[model samples]
Target: MAQQNGMVEKRGAGHWLTHAGLILGVLFIFFPIWLAFVASTVTQPEIARPPMPLLPGGHLWQNYSKALTSGINAPVALMLFNSAVMAIGIAVGKIAISLLSAFAIVYFRFPGRHLFFWLIFLTLMLPVEVRIVPTYEVAANFGMLNSYGGLILPLVASATATFLFRQFFMTVPDELAEAARVDGAQPMRFFVDILLPMSRTNIAALFVILFIYGWNQYLWPLLITTDPSMNTIVMGIKQMFPSGDDLADWPVIMATSILAMIPPVLVVIGMQKLFIRGLVESEK
Candidate 1:
């Protein structure tokens, strides 16, 4: 009886400690968001003062309205539209190209297949920042600058997406292809009918990830788009500050930051099940 009681006491103490650690972690992650939300609702003068208020303020509508309508360089609404287009374009373009490439690599036995696969794999090691100069020059020569095409196309070729699809395709049963061939199905027909449906989970997961990635793209958009009207909300937030010694609009900037996070958050929440399933299945 004494030993059992001692064990119970120890377990209780450990459980409380675990809960305390988890609560601290949650607060650490969420506190910044809470602070930004609070700032967004308060006046600039309130935020400018030291030890800023932690609670919500009364200026929510006013601050958001100002940020949406009278931005420093371009309207926040225009930037939001540009971000939506770019994010969707990147996600869709990457998924389409990755799916096709993966299907070809797995289904077809072309010359230089291994070489091509290795080349695509190599891109995983190289980031966009490393190739930005040459890529920008190519865009400039092609006259793609300041256009949606310029914003979307260059970032669409994702090595990670291609790799994920390739791994997933390899796991698909060879018997499916054989059966399709027996039924007089062309290669494209088999892919369209069979493999595409099999990859739905992966597609959803990649969509959520790629959408967030493209939505948050700052460098490429900033580099390619000289036109204010074509600015993305992620980069446009930086433009909210004046060029020189003027004080930045803390309230509007905070409000814009909150708005910028909404689409990605909704995407993740909406696709949570598929995303989790894909992550688990794709690893196998």
Candidate 2:
């Protein structure tokens, strides 16, 4: 009885320790956001003063309104719209291309199948930065610069999404395909009906991931979009800073930062169950 009680006490101690660690981690992660939120609510003068207050002030509406309507490079509203369009375009384009490519690799036994798969896989070895110069030149030559196509097309050529779908398709039961074949179903029909339904969870999860990836993109957007109207929120924030000899408006900047976090946070939160379900399904 005493031994059991000691074990129980030990478990209780460990549980509390785990909770304490989690709390510490949460605080650490949220501290910067909290500070930014606080700063967004305060006035510029208050922010310029050393050791800004921890609590929020009353300037929330004003700062956000100003940032939305009168951002330094362009209106934050316009930037937000551009970001949303780019993110959605990238996610959909990547998913569609990856799904088709993966399906071809898995379902159809074509000539040079292995060679083509290896070629696709080799793209993962190249970083975007390494290819950026040549990519930029290509975009310029193709008259894609300053266009939505330019913002998205170059970044869509990576193999990560293709690899993911290919691996998942491999794990699908071969018997399903056999059954479909016996039923006189065409390959495209089977893919559209059976495989697509099975992959819905994976698609959802990947959408969440790719959406955030596209939304947070900075370097590529910065390189491709010279027009103020085409700037994404991620890159536009830097443009908010004064070019020479003037101070940045901290309240507005912080407000924009907070605004920038909202969409991705909501996406992750809303799709968290689907994301977890997809992850588990994919692993199995």
RMSD (Cα, Å) of candidate 1?
3.1
Write model 1 residue lDDT over 54-144, tens digit each, in one string: 9999999999998888776887888999999999999999999999998888889999999989999888778889999999999999999
Task: Give per-model TM-scores.
Answer: 0.91, 0.91
- Residue pairs that clash (backbone atoms under 3 angstroms), model 1: none
Candidate 2: list runs displaced more than 4 Å: 1-18, 276-284
Worst 10 residues of 1 by lDDT: 275-284
Look at candidate 1 and tell me the lDDT of residue 133: 97
TM-score of 2: 0.91
